[model samples]
Target: MTKKPRLAVLLGDPAGVGPEMGVKLLARAENRDAAELLLIAPPSVLAAGEKIAGTKLDVIALRPGDPLRFEAGRITHLVQPEPAGFAKLGECSVPAGQAVLQALTVATELAKHGAVQGILFAPLNKHSLRLAGMDEEDELRFMQQRFEVPGFTCEFNITDQLWTSRVTSHVPLREVADLITQESVGEAVHIIDKALRSAGIARPRIAVSGLNPHAGDGGSIGLEEIEVIAPAVERLKRDGLDASGPWSPDTVFIAARRGDFDAVVSMYHDQGQIAMKLMGFERGVTLHGGLPVPVATSASGSAFDIAGKGIARIDGLQHAFDLCVQIAARA
Candidate 1:
């Protein structure tokens, strides 16, 4: 029998819908059957989530130095210590940030030591992360630093039908063009291709989006396509990757949605994000591509306004967990 992959799961933020979503996800029998989950969160936080989700999980509560076990029909929960001044249920606070950071830190360490094959975290708020002293631009970068990954890395957003990646993310729009180099574009293409394959796509057909209007219109509109993006595509093709384009950003997604490509590599952040969110805001999964250990989370942020409300959606979290399980099993 194939053993289920062990996953280190974290409840993203105490003040947001992350805990509720996590609770709801664990309540499903199929998810438990698919992976051995090591849930990391404070006992109080889990109780609150259960209250909001209206479901009680049969969990094996583990203490320090307990032997980890994978039991059928039960989750193994490692209770995280509550930090000082933890945030309230629906408000962002420094304590919330600190608590999330500590959870992530522990998960990363577990992955580093090969105790777990993957990490699945719920939605996290960047504002709260910033308050917790995350100096990097985003959580992906922070994970890169934590894992000591030296090569190129990017986030891949996935839906049931399509996937998208970006050459540059979390930077100002004005700075995007300057950052779009042939090397960076090639790296983005390669990483997405690799990630798709890791997710079980045999040979991913990657569509590379143009940085400028009309893909430079043959050098009339802009030279980025002619000079930078097109050459990068050619290089990727020559290297035996099934990559094509410098396609117009507007039309690239249309082609992808029409089943022309397996993934689209965009030039900047919003180029792919706006479309992905608009297409499936509730079911999008964000895979931290190129990480040694599979790490994924919901593409959506912590919906603080509806934190304690039982109406919080778990679709994204479900997709995230499923993808993590798939990749971790392959690994």
Candidate 2:
């Protein structure tokens, strides 16, 4: 029999619904059966999550520096001590940010050493991350820096039926056009194609979205489609990739949803995000592609308003875990 892939699962933020969602995800028999899970969080946080979720997990808890073991039918939790003055429920604070940083650091180290095959984290607050002193634009960049990945990397938003990636993310609208070069566009397409294939799609059909309205209408609206995007698509096609478009961003998802393409590469963040979230907000997953190891999280952010309400949905986290497992198993 094949060994199950070991995964490091982090409870996103102490003050958010991450702990509760982690508890709920682990309570399922099927999740436990699928992989050897290492649940990482503070003891206080896990207890609070069990209380909020009303579902206690059978976890073998370990402190820092303790030897790790993965037992059948049980989770192995690494106890991440809560920082002093950690934020209270639904509040963002430096202590909460420090704790999240610590957890991610440990998980990244494990992945670097090949101790874990994948990392699945719940929703985290960017505000808390910033408060904790993360200077990078986002956690994906932080991971890239920590792993020292020198090549192209991008965030992938996915649903059960469709996958989307962006050339430029977390940038202002005014700067997006200048950033959309043929090299950047080609990198986005190449990475998404590789990611989809890693997830078991043999030959992914990718549709590229244009930067301007109606894809520049043959250069009447903008020259980016004619000059940058079209040339990039042609270059990628000549390189033996099944890539097409400069498709109109407005209707790209319509074709993608109708089974026209396996994935869509967008010019900017909101172009793809708005469509994916609209299609399935509760089940969307954000995958950090081009990393040394598979890492995934729910597309949804830390819902501070709904923290500790016992009403946070687990569908997105579940999907994230499922996809992480798929990619990790392949790795």
For all candidates in order, the CA lDDT equals 0.90, 0.92
Please give the lDDT score at residue 14 for candidate 2: 83
How many angstroms is residue 91 displaced in model 2 relative to the true structure, after the best TM-score fit?
2.0
Clashing pairs in 2: none
- Evaluated against the true structure, the overall lDDT of model 1 is 0.90
Predicted structure with the largest TM-score when compared to the true one = 2
In model 1, where is the ten-residue run with the lowest total lDDT? 62-71
Give the per-residue lDDT digits (tens) of candidate 1, residues 133-246. 999998889889999999889999998869999999998999999999999999999998888888788999999999888787888988999889999999999999999998
For residues 1-331, could you state the per-residue lDDT of candidate 2 as single tens digits? 1688999999898899998898999999899999999998888888988999998899998888889998899999998877888579999999888888888999999999988999999888888989989998889998888888997899999987799999999888999999999999999999999999998898899999999999999899999999999999999999889999999999999999999999999999999999999999999999999999999999998898999999999999999999999889888
Clashing pairs in 1: none
- Per-residue error for 192 in candidate 1, Å, reads 0.9
Off by over 4 Å in 2: none
Root-mean-square deviation per candidate? 1.3, 1.1
